[model samples]
Target chain A: MKLKCPTCGREYDEPVQRCECGEPVEFKLFEGEPYIAKTVWERFYDFWPVEPAMELSLGEGDTPLVKSRIGRELGVRLYLKNETANPTWSFKDRGTFLAVSYAVKAGYGAVGTVSTGNMAASVAAYAARAGLKAKILVSESASDEKLKAVGVYGADVIRVKGDYGRLYFESLKLGEKLGVYFINSDNPFRVEGYKGIAFEIAEEITPDYVLIPTSSGGLFRGIAKGFIELRESGLIEEIPTLVAVQAEGCSPICRAFSEGKERIGRFENPKTIAKAIANPYPPSGNAVLKLLREFGWKCLSVSDEEILEAQRKLAGEGIFVQPASATGVAALEKLVEGGGIEEGAKIVSILTGSGLKTLATAGQGNARECPLEGLENCVSF
Target chain B: MKLKCPTCGREYDEPVQRCECGEPVEFKLFEGEPYIAKTVWERFYDFWPVEPAMELSLGEGDTPLVKSRIGRELGVRLYLKNETANPTWSFKDRGTFLAVSYAVKAGYGAVGTVSTGNMAASVAAYAARAGLKAKILVSESASDEKLKAVGVYGADVIRVKGDYGRLYFESLKLGEKLGVYFINSDNPFRVEGYKGIAFEIAEEITPDYVLIPTSSGGLFRGIAKGFIELRESGLIEEIPTLVAVQAEGCSPICRAFSEGKERIGRFENPKTIAKAIANPYPPSGNAVLKLLREFGWKCLSVSDEEILEAQRKLAGEGIFVQPASATGVAALEKLVEGGGIEEGAKIVSILTGSGLKTLATAGQGNARECPLEGLENCVSF
Candidate 1:
């Protein structure tokens, strides 16, 4: 049970989120073929570092890969890895489910997370299901609407008024003293859980390109590792080119990659409608930069306007995703405009969360009103 | 293809939503073992009266049956049939997917539905996916927030000012004249699509009791018929006790059943927070009443307070469903208190929709604020 740092090559047998060198650490690699079963946990048991408690599952993963009708117009065959169909209506469920299992297996009676968004709700739901107390610590400025879902799952949500950003790192130390496992965004087990996304996609189709919506960069690193593992195991002939999609308003990793910087600098005064992915200083940003450089992967950022248009296009295709989730689709349009992708090439875009989470924007001034009498007049073909 | 009247025993050669005798019409029964395949349409081809166009699917059905923790306290093993995992975040996707497939295959250029809720969003999404025009007719009083998801799917959401109740029947006739198939809530194909719920559940577990959240009687009738078909095909030895659960504020069918009425009499001025199921005059009420009598089934209603409590209870179990969906759990509690269910009996409750749809109530005055300094002081065990 040794945790290894990818940067300094430091190994520790005790539980630690980051290495002494201030870089994120992950479990040491273990080699085994994926176990075949129904649920993701069962099917990928050999790939997971910890044995997941079989009973602790809300039936997460195995999301549908819906074919996109917009592909014909974009000059490529496209499929949406619809992560919105997960239990918590987001891809975070994949990570949270696994993290909670580890916490329960380690005999932790309480767990905590520092998110007022998708991760908070996911951890709360999983923690409640696993019969563990959940302590959700969010910034003082967190929206009441966003925290509602998290509270509904019986998690004790606390709003920290000052230096809330620093609390992300401090919570781990405080949680240790309180015997509560803090599964922040880029926890090792959570990153391991995200690999299931890559595993399931490969089972469905061997895409030439996989566009992922990048936030804290944990998802990007996990997916990249998943493909690498598959190739190493002879399960896949070649790993698809993984593209990191980000919002133009706040994209530290993409900016660093485009600038040929070895490390990501903190983004300043972030302003994006895709608030879900608006991470100013992502913890795993350096790791993502390394992956992008190592794999020759492209990192692109789209404006809020493009993200909105992509959202509408997805809705037109009968897939409603949040603006942040639409970043991948928006990136595809940019690639098409620049002729970056070949015609008829199989491409997959990850739709990270459901639009239902951000319905206020979708409903804003879009509905048309009609009269009662002679309603047939309004029913024009 | 021939359509048969369940009440009058009359048959028609052409497709019709309901019989001239004022009762719903269904495709004549077909007999064969289910064709084992990936999607529900392919697997259940033998049972379908009309051949569904294979490509018309938004990954509907195949929902997970999650085991409940609260059941242990009630002395029964409970499983929540999590239909919220459907693409549209509701069970209505099943019916809409099937109905939209029929419309596309029947060469209809346009489709219409009379709804402002789950069915509306489901039809709009599926119609958009199938590349058909969707004319959604909603009542004037539908909340803008509720209709937002429906409109996002690029549907023609027209608000009708006149009598919405009469408009339901009139839309069918007008839809025919306008070359559009009007798929109101109780459409035969939609009901047939719901049969997949029963089929899937039966494949997983044969419960001693199955609780359903009844609205327009479509879902209730669908599950009943699904079990009947399974028995007819020798798939299951016996059918579970089918219980219809409804909100007490608007429980016309339940009221009628408790009073031993042959036909359901509409309840006026219905008031319930569960707007999704608050149908004052459900079109399929009579059919549901008939099933209740024929099968010696029970129909029960829970107060709004009880429904709210059930919603909270479900959230505590890591499953957050809408108020209407929680009626099944509310009914289960009532049954337990009344000594209706036997100890250790296997019971399955249907969680019809997700709580994300009604976040306003869940978010109402539940969030708490804390100070920024010394946040560790708040991290008490």
Candidate 2:
């Protein structure tokens, strides 16, 4: 499997997570005909760097490309790739399933990840499924309630008390030394796994644009590569305009892109209800920036209010997602108003995770109280 | 649209929620060839009583039937019908979607349900999608945190302060009077919707036995009808032995079945960690009991401890589910020990809902603290 650093143009014959220049590495574009299979792993059989452990799959990919009513209101055909239907109720399961397969095949006895939310739970569950130990390293500020979902999978969750930014790189270094395959946000295999989303979306419809909620930029890069591969394989005529969306509260990548900067600087005091996508200093920020500049793609950020509004709107459409997942929809209105997207363009928004994970911040429903005797009147308009 | 009461053998020409005798009504056996379609609603097109609103679908049903490792330990081949992968992260979405479709077609401006958990969320979501106002009548004791998931779907959540049991029947009566279709547990269309699970399972493997986590008995009855219809349609030779699993804390149906009683009595002060299946007086209790007796099926109840153990075991297999969802797995061991199931028998257990729905009761994960400097040692064996 040939790997190359998008930012530095350095190449490696062996699978590597990052380049010597500290940029995330990615697999070379794979060109192959699609196969008739139930799972995306088998359908895009030649795309993956390693054989996906089918027995270890939790039905991660092949989520429904649900047609949305929101698109009609905006004069565009909108479809939501509902990733929340995944095993762990998040898009992370796709990457986790693939990365864990590689870890198992590579003779790693354990797998590790530096995440407190989706990735941590995903790795823990997959590691348990593979009969391998898992060392989940979380930031000191990670809540116990949030960690409960991860811990239930029997992973050894260690809350490292130090700079959360340093924990990502430190865990990788320590994991390699300890023989623990750390599949962090932008791990090469993890990014490759995300290609399934793009593949699945293409299977349903050829879109003019695809909006992705970006954090560490693994998902953006993976989807970009997926479409790129599909085009190279003569499957699709052209790659859709990929839009990288971020929470305005913590949008380093968008800030850098807007300022026309090649490199991204860390955004200080990152805070947002969309905590899942609130990365101040994304590890693959430069890699994503390069892709955006090269392809003339877009990077936009949505306000917390807009994100919440989108979350409610999606809930109205019968798909409730986390605030982070709603960013794409949140950015849709702005994109339309700004004339960045055409009126009749077919658009696909990737909903990244389940809203149940962030119940505390999800605004309360207008629940009225009624005595049983008065229930008839209470329910009446 | 023929409906029949299983208990009283009374038939209705028009669609009705329940018989005059107070038993849940179900659609008569539909004999038709399965069609090639993406969604189960279309695949089983000939079976449904009303036209399924395809535009209003939330991509429910057709969940993965994952092969399980736990079955190996029990000397049985196990498959988990992961209903948690449904739109609302529960099997209720299947029933809710179908019932909501009927409600919309029948020109009901509003739909309602009596549930505080999965069903409430499912109904609210589908109602929102169908553009029908939803009145989710939850119990007074229902947690605010749990209601957030349902409320997010823009449903009017009504916390009725009275006997939760009576609210079910009351909602139906009030809903009809107010032109609000209440798709309560065991609504004819809702039950028919659950047939998709059975159809999907049969498509994969003709299991020797199917384990259902029984609560209100709607799911069990629906699945039973699916298999029976499949057999009648000559799709399968025979129906699999259906087992209704329940928590010891609130097992009215099991208690009645074990006592050889025709009717089930209300379980006094029902309490269990598996709140999802804590229906003390299941609306379809008599119906499920009759199915068990007629088919020579089994009804087993496991303790809270066993349910928790099974939940952990499933999590270990990378499928974390709620306590109610784990009941089938929990009952597997007891069924094997009692010779209720044969050696190497193909067993399919229904994982009814997502674990995130009941995180408060979900046991905590063991998280250890480690400083950044000591992270390596902490991660080391």
Candidate 3:
């Protein structure tokens, strides 16, 4: 499979996670007709760099594209691509499944990832499914409660006591030496796997814009490539305007984009309730910045207040997602208020993970107490 | 709109939660061919009692029936009907969606349910989607942490300080008087909604046996009706043998069945890690017992140790589920050892809910610590 660096435009024949210039590499655009199949992987059979291990699949992709009532209030036709319905209750499973498939095929006995939340659990689960050893490297600050989900999958979780950013690059170097396939965020195959989200969204409706909650910029880049491939394959006539959303606390890409900077600098002391998307120095920030500038795409950052408000709003509509997942909706409100998006335009927001993962951050439900004898009085309200 | 009591054989022309005899009522057998449609609600259109609210759907049901490697060791072909993939990460969403649809159509402004776990969350989510106020009556012992998932859906959660068992009946009585439709466990429409699981399973593979993790017995009864209707519709030649699996700590239905009793007695001090299936006096226990006797089906109860072991085993297969969801797998092992099931018999185990919901009891992951500078040595093993 041919992979090319979006930022440096360097091509590589073999599968490589990043370029010599230290930028994430992605597979070249794939052009092929869609086929009738049960899963998105099979439907877009011609797109993936490696054969997806169907037996190892935990029903990751093909999540429900739920129509939202909030859309009417916002003067837009909104649809939520509920990725929380995935196996591990996150969008990471899509990438994990594809990357694990490649790892298994390439004769790697183990798979590794540097994440404490969704990706760690995803890789561990997939590795267990594929009967591969998994070394999950998490930051020292990662909570034991958060690691419980990952540990249950029988992965060897290691809390690396050092700079978290350096650990990402260090794990990759160590994994390669130890024959552990490191499928970190923006891994070439992992990014390719995310194309399924775009493919599934297109299958339902052709929207004017798609809002994605960006962290390490892997998900945004993957979706962009997916739509680009679909357009090249003659699947869709026009590409939707892609919007990269980030928390105001840690928005390196948005800051760089708005400042007209080609390269992104690390944001110091990143802190937000949306911990899943709170990456200070995203590995693929340059690649995402290049895509945004080249395509005239937008990058917006939402405040914690706005994110929590959006999360509550989504919950009101029956889909409760993590604070990070709510950033898309938060950004949508800003875009509509500024008239950046036309009225009645079709829009799709990507909900990246399940809210259950971050229960501590989810605001209380205002539960009331009642005695059984006084139930009648309680029921009256 | 025909309803019949499975135990008493009493008939009702209008929709009712239960019979005058205090047994859970169910819809009469619907005989119609499956149609080509997108959702299970549409595909099995002829099966449901009320027209499903398509616009209010959060994409519940039609979960993946994953083929398992555990079967190879058991000398039986095993498949896991992953209901954890449902909208609320549990099978309750299927029933909640259908019941809420009926509630909305019947013009009920509010809906309520008596549950502290999956059902509470499911009802709250659907009620929010249907624009109906939800009164989730949870027990006094229900943790606020657990309720956060339910409360996030903007439901009015009430911790009723009284006998948890009596609250179920009280809610229904109060709900009807206050124009609040209480879709509790075994609500006719809720049970009817579960038919989608059977329909989806049949579509994938016609198993020789189906294992259900039984608690309130609504799920078991719903599945039984689905298979029986499929057989009556001439869709399948034979109905698979249905097995109701329960934890030894609280197995009223199994205890009654084993004793050859006509009715189930309340299990005292019911305690188990599988809290989701710890219903001491299942509302539909008598109904499920009757089905077991009529069909000569099996009712097995496993220990807490076995359930935890099964949960670990499932996690090893990359499908981490709650303790209650693992009971089916635990029972499968027991049945295999006892030669209760034939060799190479096809078995489908229902994984009822997500493990993330019960993280407190999920046990700890063995996470080791390593410095980032020495990460190369940590990953070597």
Which candidate comes out best when scored by lDDT? Answer: 3
**How do the residues B1-381 of candidate 2 rate in per-residue lDDT, one tens digit apiece?**
889999999999988999999999999887742222477888778888888888888789888888889989778999999998988999999899889888888899999999989999999999999899999999888888889999999999988898888988888889889999999999999999999999988887889989999999999999999999999999999899999999999999999988989999999989899998999999999999999999999999999999999999999999989999999999998889988577789999999999998888877756899999998899999
Candidate 1 local distance difference test against the native: 0.86
- The candidate that achieves the highest DockQ relative to the unseen native structure: 2
Judge candidate 3 at residue A371 and give its lDDT.
98
Per-residue alpha-carbon lDDT of model 1 for A1-381, expressed as tens digits? Answer: 889999999999999999999999999887642223477777767888888765667888888887787888766888889888878899998888888889998999999998888899899999989999998998888878888888899999998888766887889888888899999989999998899989988888888999999989878878888889889988999999899999999999899998999999989999999989999899899999988888888899999999999999999878889999999989987777766577788889999898999987885524556776687778767
Candidate 3, residue A358: lDDT: 93
Which regions of candidate 3 deviate over 4 angstroms? Answer: A1-37, B1-37
Clashing residue pairs found in predicted model 3: none
Q: Write the per-residue lDDT of candidate 1 for residues B1-381, one digit (tens) a residue.
A: 989998999999988898999999998788632222476667777877667654556677878788887788888988889988888999998888888888988899889898988888889998888899999999988888888989899999888887888888888888888889988889999898888888988878778889999888899988999999999999999999999998999999999998888888878999998888998889999999988889888898999998999898888878888899999998887777766678788888998888999888775525557675676778776
Which segments of candidate 1 are over 4 A away from where they belong? A1-37, A337-340, A365-371, B1-37, B337-340, B363-365
Q: State each candidate's clash count.
A: 3, 0, 0
